[model samples]
Target: MQPAFTRERVGVHAADMVHGITAVTDAWQPGRTVDVSAAMQSVTARVTARTLFSTSIGDQDVTDIQHCLVVLFSGVYRRMTAPLGLWEKLPTPGNRRFRAAHDRLRGLIHRIVRTHRRTADAHDDLLTALAAAHGDGPGDSLSDRELCDQVMTLLVAGTEPTGHALAWAVHLIATHPEVEARLHAETDRVLAGRRLPELADLPRLEYTGRVFTEVLRLYPPGWMFTRTTTCETELAGRALPRGADVLYSPYALHRDPRLFAEPGIFDPDRWHPDRARSVPRGAFIPFGAGNRKCIGEHFGTVEALLALSTLCARWRLRPVPGAEVRPRPETTLGTGPLPMLAHPRAPG
Candidate 1:
């Protein structure tokens, strides 16, 4: 529960999709880039199961976990948005399902923990990391409940954003053939068809990262971060009031004409650190900058880059016929129909 979602899990988590891509690619044998949404799903499921439970799960378990996530998120939103006088005694079927999801997730994780402890070969995956990371910090580890809660958090947080980001990246790359072509060229130049893109390949993937940055800007997975005022302070010269709820909207910030030369255009080069330096601190926050920013930013970024680069290293995505990619705003803005198709990239 107390395990800090660190950079380490990305490698283990990546193994899931790398396998999925190989399986999918071999089946289609496409010569151009193959859209790897199915592969992305595999990675997302793997991250949730492996990161939280420190175990592997089947396709059905992954599907069940996603269903649980939907319920849990909906329940949270309902509780937050419910009327003040609503009775707690009344629980709907949906709430029941939600709680069941929560319970199932908890039960599954603890069983995995117990199983791992019993086994001699408990490998150094996230569960192993959590087992080793026992004390809260130095001498403190999480309690069983805390571990379950943290695992639950990872199940939801680890999946939704990365999944949506993958979808967005695919849609963006698919529709913009020029951008897609550039990405294909970039991955080829950087990796030269080495088995898969590794953490080592990330530094060489500057523009690939920018594609993610720009995509995050235009379609941020964590679209709006909200906070209630614990202490009053001025923001943008506005007088602050205590207890005021505020939202930081990256969508608005990313598209502001004053900050971007052409906000609507898909331009990864704009994120070149030299050019990026000019944007105001709060204005450029795709992952939210500074202390209170998301813990998963770097982790998620790396995961997305690896997934995108790995998939692009082999397959191409193009628009699906009659499919409209419209933004459905919820916790994250998901593009509906995910309007894309995958084809294999011919070797350069």
Candidate 2:
């Protein structure tokens, strides 16, 4: 059976407010998101690094891991549509890149594992925890190959949607100032000038949380999610054949008027408690549902909330010169090749 979708504590989100941005703002604060994509990469890189490598893999290693992610992300669509035989030509450029990236990622993880053995200190990083076998052994412990697979899974999943989600959160909040104002109000009211928001503060950021929920409604990072049916079943009384590919898209579903009132508009109020509490479990499924739901939902939202509050606290984004916020409906939802104008506002 597939695992259930539950919230996860993404390593990068909580930590980046300290490690990545503070450094940038103190020393390298540019007035624009000139390298927003690169920033996304940096954030995801740190998350993956901290999660798996802990003490062993450094910034350069993170870059290589990001490269593998790019290789796989760039080719995922091609693989989905390419003919099996043509796709299997192992020497294809993208496949070759994937192979190289996969190797580098695995090598980095192994090196980290070796280093953890030498230290033998009770380290808290995910990889060190995995390396030492935290719970049980063999029957319960992960093999080296499983270790590699988990690392690969984390690298691919930990980075991509999150990176994209971070980028979109910036774009969405920047473009919608009313929404931005409300967002600030909620954060300011709930956070109450407290020491930076933490896991504990998450529940208090309800409206800010809905800002993410609404953003997910408009341009969810995981726009098109899929699953293969295992047994014959009926959804809305429509017969679904077993083994058939079931493509249930949050993007399409969220826009279906039958599922949402005025389904075409972007309104955070729609997610207000009374309304949100009433939403059918599957009506808006950006993170997906059932056993295969997103494991990092909590972590991703927390990361976004923290980062958005921090950035909005500092800068106001205006459309940049020669740039517009355009949606690219790639496998994941994202802004176009061109980023939006996001000139930081003077702090009030």
Candidate 3:
């Protein structure tokens, strides 16, 4: 799975991201209000489907997936916040809905895996790579069930968080004219009148990259995660027994004044190479740390950089007047129903 998301492999999927962003931008009309969150989610979902399965999933399928995710994640949040796990065992309405959504999503993934296995070598995508991978031991080979589980994990991880982070970037750009101006300038200079950005142009879009890094720092999609101690450990002079469940919030860590100057400000320059190194290790863990770090980190970053550059190049999305735009922290920190009007940018 890690090999499937290496920088070189991820670069092969750049065209998929370009196509997805084009589809979204093509549907946008001047002054038409678009749900930025939903639109970003649709773009990422399409891109992930193509890159992961070597097939295009219909708009309706994306919608169905999103609906199931919403139901399932809300249930997870409930279980996480509750004091005891006993309620989860009960067949309550919430629990029932969660189980149904889980089954529905799993069934879809299983069908996809079965279909892909028939023509495994015909396609060049993540599924094919995983299917062909082998190791020394027989147990190293993935069973159908294991493959389905891996795909489900990648689908959820690759789609929702990246989409939500892009939505936050769009919102931040809309509200902060200074930041938006800088972003547009960088894209215009790098793209030089091109309608779409290519993987080669990533190096020149440095500011665009910083903007996204800042976006992640401010509004990381995986807002909170829980880790269990494998062995007894001590933290901040407190002793912890093995198997202790410790919950931490990247959302809170990113806002600490000690790690970042004026932490609440939407300043991209803070991510500049010189300043970026000033932040201590373990202070920035938007994608977790150690072996548990996200497998798709580089892939997600490329998708975001390309998508943001593509959108910023052709149009500016402005929050609709009087619309309330705020973070809605669920499974991911998403901006729920973010209505923004697309204004075409004047030619460079």
Candidate 4:
């Protein structure tokens, strides 16, 4: 999974990212507020599907997948917070809907895998790797069910979090015009007049990178994650029995004044070269830590940076007046239909 998202592989999807961003910008009109959340999701989903499968899925297929994702995400938080998984089996309307959503997504992925096995070509994509794994033979081979699970995991994990991150980046950039100015200046200097941002240009666009890092610090999509003790252990002064579940909130830790100065503020300059290294080791985990970290960290980073530079260079997205734009935490801390007015800028 990790290898499939190497810089080389992920860079192959750069053209698709450019086209997706262009599609959104082409539809933008002055003073016409659009749902930035949905727009970002559409772009991220197209990028994910094209990069993951490298196949052309019809518009209806894309729509169906998006619908299934919404249904699945809506009930996941409740199911997780419910005691003993009791609510999951109640067969209420929501529960049934969730079950149907899960089944539909799973079945769709299974069919995708089977179709890939039959005719999918040798492409540098996640599906190809999974297909190879499934054909490893005998005890080493992944079952069809296991392959479907992997596909579902990658699809859900890859799409929503990256989409939300980009959406939040746009929102933050819009609200902070000073930072936005710096980002635009950096993009203009680094990219010159390129149609799309390249993988090699990432380092030169330092301010853009800092802006994204700040966004992650303030609103990490994986706001809360859980870990379990492998065996009986003691931490600080507490005793933890084996198999105990511990929850860590990046949302809370990122805002701890002890770790960050004026923690509530959104200051991208805090991530400057000299200042960034002074923070504590575990205090800045946007993508997570250790071996269990997200496999798509590099992939998502490249995607967000490219989208940010590409779009920020041409247009500014401002939040609509009187719109309710607040964090709605679920599987990921996300917002709903963030209405933003897009204003075009002169080309560099």
Candidate whose TM-score is highest:
4
For residues 1-348, what per-residue lDDT tens digits would candidate 2 score against the true structure? 012112433533366534544433334344544546556655766665665565566777766666667767777767667787587467877688767766776787777666676775756566655655645554777667777777777767767777777777767676688888877776667657653556556677777777777888877888887788889988877998998787767888888887778876768789887887867778887778877787767666666677666655555555566675666777677674434444544333
lDDT of each: 0.70, 0.66, 0.87, 0.82
Candidate 3 displacement at residue 340 in angstroms: 0.8
Off by over 4 Å in 2: 1-13, 16-18, 21-33, 88-96, 117-121, 132-140, 186-197, 236-238, 338-347
For model 3, how does the per-residue alpha-carbon lDDT over 111-185 read when each residue is reduced to its tens digit? 777888897767888888887777998778888898888877777788889999999999998999999998888
Off by over 4 Å in 3: 56-101, 133-140
* TM-score of each model, paired residue for residue: 0.81, 0.83, 0.90, 0.92
Tens-place lDDT per residue, model 4, 64-89, is 77778778777888977899988788
> Looking at candidate 1, what is the lDDT of residue 234?
88
Cα RMSDs, all models: 4.0, 3.8, 2.5, 2.2
The clash count for each model shown is 20, 4, 0, 0
Q: Write candidate 1's Cα lDDT for 1-348 as tens digits.
A: 223455554555556545533543556544333344444554676655655554444556666776667567657656656688273336878767767877886777676566765662656555556555554567687656666666677677777778788888888887788888888888988898684887788889988998998898888877788887878888889988999988888888889999888999988888898999887767877677777777777667777788788778776767767766677677766664453555766646
Name the Cα RMSD for model 3.
Answer: 2.5
Lowest-lDDT window of 10 residues in candidate 3? 55-64
Q: Considering lDDT, where higher is better, how would the candidates rank from best to worst?
A: 3, 4, 1, 2
Model 2 lDDT on a 0 to 1 scale: 0.66
Best model number under lDDT? 3
* Candidate 2, position 29, lDDT: 42
RMSD of candidate 1 to true structure, Å: 4.0
